[model samples]
Target: MVDPRRFKSRSAVNAYGGLGIGQSVTNWHVVGRSRASRRGQRAVKRVLFLAGRAAIRGDNALARRYANRLKSGWEDRKAIRDVARRILFVACAMWIRKEVYRDELVSVPSPTR
Candidate 1:
């Protein structure tokens, strides 16, 4: 599986380095907040959707569980938020560990399950 970190461009990596909210670069406040514009929200949604889709093929147990819920009639947008939440949760965990986001078996069952 492709490492999602590789998708981060050089600039993003630099941005991550300068990130003050936490250690993970992807943990930007705009991601979880209502501060972004409509277009920005759409973009973030796309990213979250793509990440959730990819997670189905990955070791991210949370993502897989979310995908399953999606298949069971949950709205795609809600499922995407679940993915975003998982992403943020992992990001926070990474921040606490002083490490970058790592692909792991996210042992917890998904909330939507």
Candidate 2:
């Protein structure tokens, strides 16, 4: 499952609906229809979006702070996407390195200056 696509970088994971996490409309030029097909797996995108939602609602303070920090400038859904992107990045790193997930090791810089 990890190397099936042989992703070259963390950004590749966003192809799984990472770009459209909080977007109601992906295409801006074509209002009614699109001239081209959209990329990425829709199922994975939904799953990732759900995971973002869960991250904010769950009891993980780190995840909460991460999402909250983003909220200062972004909409709630956008913040969720940021969290989802982080999730994808971390998942990719852990999978590539074969490392176990340790929440304590994942740190977030304070939002305040």
- Give stretches of model 2 more than 4 Å off: 1-5, 20-38
Residue runs of model 1 more than 4 Å from their true location after superposition: 1-47, 99-113
lDDT of 2 by residue, 65-93 (tens): 66557746656665666676667766777
Please report the TM-score between candidate 1 and the true structure: 0.43
lDDT of 2 at 61: 54
Q: How big is the positional error of residue 44 in model 2, measured in Å on the Cα after superposition?
A: 0.8
Q: List the residue pairs that clash in candidate 2.
A: none
- TM-scores of all candidate predictions against the true structure: 0.43, 0.65
The Cα local distance difference test for each model comes to 0.51, 0.62
Best by lDDT: 2
